[model samples]
Target chain A: MNLIFWSSESDDDRRDTQVGSWLGELDPGRDDATYWMRFHRDVVDGSRFELARRRQAAELTVVGVVSSWSRTLVPVALAAAAAAGIMLAQPRLDQVEPPILVEDVLTMGLGDPMPALFVDDEEGGLLLASEIY
Target chain B: MTSHQKIEDPRFGDGELVRRAREGEEEAYALLVGRYMRPAYLVALSVTRRHEDAEDAAQEAFLVALQRLEECRDPERFGGWLMTIVRNRSRNLLRRESLRETSVLPETAKSGEPLPDRVTERSELDETLQAALAELTPVQREVVLLHDLEGWKHREIAERLDLPSGTVRSHLHFARKALRGKLEGVLTDHVKG
Candidate 1:
């Protein structure tokens, strides 16, 4: 005859009961509880440590790479961009001029009053203005 | 040493390890990893099934947890926090792979015996648990494995998974019921023989 017991129980309790119940029915002739004990041992031994370590190492390596890349690349990229901007702006700085350009213009066109926007007394600039009017 | 002392003692517990780790103690983090690696991998393997996949998920989870360790609110509950990372990574991997066609693989029983009247050993129990876990919805399986294997309480699980306590309880209930039903049938058949 076969009968099953079902109940809502805590896991640890269920685990213990399940182990006991399953083994009780086995009826192995040996006086030793080796089989039952081994069952518990095997359940406890389900953990695999070596593979887990290797996996952890591989993961740390990946994280190290990503973190280093971000830390190094971001600043380097920003500095490189800043350097490029300074290099590109160098020629533009030379285009700025002082008031000396007005002096040069006066030197070239001083004899021509209308062109220079000033009237020279030696050229009768005031008379020429009166005659044109 | 007592497991309770190991888990609950503030000076020697996972929370202490996290506090030390956050303070730049690399050894503390390493110890924490050593302590939780098996359970973490088991949870991942429960979801992914394949060793390689589980390893990837487990590693990624740890790395993520390490990177964001500062964000953990209660360092005393480090195990629960790390476990959440494991489940999240596993779920994300599963989602990414969901588009591809895949089928649940059968467990390799100890012998070539047929289904009815088959003896279930402890190794078989582990394998059966893995297979049944794989067959569950990711969320359900995660809650179940965390509760059963890792011995996490419902509130701890809910906090880690960012789920409602009621939802965690319901998932646990359903998963336990399903697994029990499956195992009961197999055991009853074997007893009849």
Candidate 2:
């Protein structure tokens, strides 16, 4: 449940950090370079197996894991923290001001003659901007 | 007949490839990957801005696309569909790793094999271009790279990025102006040195 986030400069740094942590949990006297290598390999293999197991348990194909991994490398807790940060940092779409329309700018230039201006719509139909408003 | 036998007919279009892939033909799927991998990587790189991350995202997108191959309404437009997947995956990666620090200029690998002087000069230019590209916003960078670097038309770029054609044109214009300014500065600095 304790997911250590890898923020190291390189993959080697991540591997070393992970290996060092794993070695600390084991018998130091018995952990040789070969043992460490095997342990590292097993950890990586185990991660893959865990991913496959979870995918199958959820009744999803291996391909479904692609989307899940693409969405987040963090666990639920860390992802929640990220979501909270994002909510606090970014303004909601409704809260943000709408883009200034070309018609609005043109009307502004014309000394507020009217709030309407002819513009081409998405379907190539000419309509008054104020009509839509 | 086997997929290999089908492929040997010399008339295997993208639509045919999709059909074969949907039939669980691994060779057909591999062919599709070979066809789109470079453009997919380029599209992803434009968004991710990191070679390794772009590569990973592109590879993931391929898997996702393969899974959803049946959902493609028009198999002839598979390249565009695959590109959309790549762009989405790249954007997802960007959002997930938003907090990660990124270098302004990505490191370029020197070729181990000997290259002609012209090739080396072009490579340096490409490096400068990439550095300038790093300055643009992600959307601007994507449009510019797709239109200019990948030689995609504005309409094609718009479809791939799910933007209006006019919007694509606007982004391309601004990106080109910015890139020209940056490249000029680099050239001036080179001349001074």
Candidate 3:
């Protein structure tokens, strides 16, 4: 006879209970409990970290990679910052600009609209954009 | 019905932990997660019926629970509340995933290939157990896993699940019976080995 509310007596039934217990393994092991602890610590401390960087750098300087999804998720703040930097470095989309010729493309990064001296084939030597006809 | 507070000497009660967590104490929140992770996962498995989806749903639910800590009106019953989040997350995952894929037995297991080591045996056994668990009703699965696996009392399961204690017992009795029937060979071999 089976007793639900009492200690199970039958060993076969006991073993069955263990089989049910084994399903707990489907949860990530206790290591995840620790990993998430550390991850939350980093989040609380305002220390930004990357899973890929932790792997490449040979040291978990900030947060450790906790799971498989670590490889896929870039730190959103880092991605946003990188994107913003690239956008700022590029010319404003709203501004009208000349199409990039070879020399103009080469000179595009010199500075913020600085008067760059490029070799002028028409005038034969280094001349500022203002000096060019 | 007893809370895990009575099962083990956790340093703080769920109400206290929830309060501390809401106050930005990561340690308290981590403790809560550690304490309830398995129960949360089991609850998720009840709804998802797939280990992978259950794991995702459990983790997502924990995150969501943490985010909405303020909304947990009854922090003392945090386990019950978290289980609700887990169930909702699992159902939402099902709705979103639309039954992605069933657990297929590993190729080696299906081919009758020799399991070279203990690792393979455990892996195969785990999948088999999952498949067997799929046969039980959702409530039965939840009751059995919580009562048998997590070692919760029948009354605790009843309170958490909002079922009568007697009903919880009946579910457990029948769930174990069903599992015994389906897992007879596997369980016998496991018992012997």
Candidate 1 residues lying further than 4 Å off, grouped into runs, are A1-133, B1-10, B13-15, B95-131, B187-193
What is candidate 2's lDDT per residue for A8-125, written digit by digit as tens? Answer: 3232211122212211221211324343233223333333433344335455446677767866755776888998999988877688888999988876756546544788889999
Docking class of 2: incorrect
C-alpha RMSD by candidate, in order: 13.0, 34.6, 20.7
| DockQ of all predictions against the true structure, Cα-based | 0.04, 0.01, 0.06
lDDT, candidate 1, B48-159, per-residue tens: 7655566678777777776677788899778778887887798788877664323432343334444332343445544554555555676776666566655667777777
- Candidate 1 vs candidate 3: the DockQ winner is 3
TM-score, B chain alone, candidates in order: 0.64, 0.69, 0.79
Candidate 2: stretches off by over 4 Å = A1-133, B1-12, B98-131, B185-193
Please name the candidate that would achieve the greatest DockQ relative to the true structure: 3
Residue B83 in model 2: shift from native, Å? 2.0
Task: Give model 1's TM-score for chain A to 2 decimal places.
Answer: 0.25
lDDT per residue (tens digit) for residues B1-193 in model 2: 0011111333677899888777656556656765665567767887887665786787778778766777989998888889889989999998776543233222331434443322433345446656777887778877665555445666666676777766766676676677667776554444334
For residues B1-193, write the lDDT of model 3, one tens digit per residue. 1212222337789999888677556567667776777788789888887656887788777777877777899998899889989999999998876533235455675687753432443466667777788888898989888877777877678778878777777778888878777777875665445
The 0-to-1 C-alpha lDDT of every candidate, in the order given, reads: 0.60, 0.61, 0.68
Full candidate order by TM-score, most accurate first: 3, 1, 2
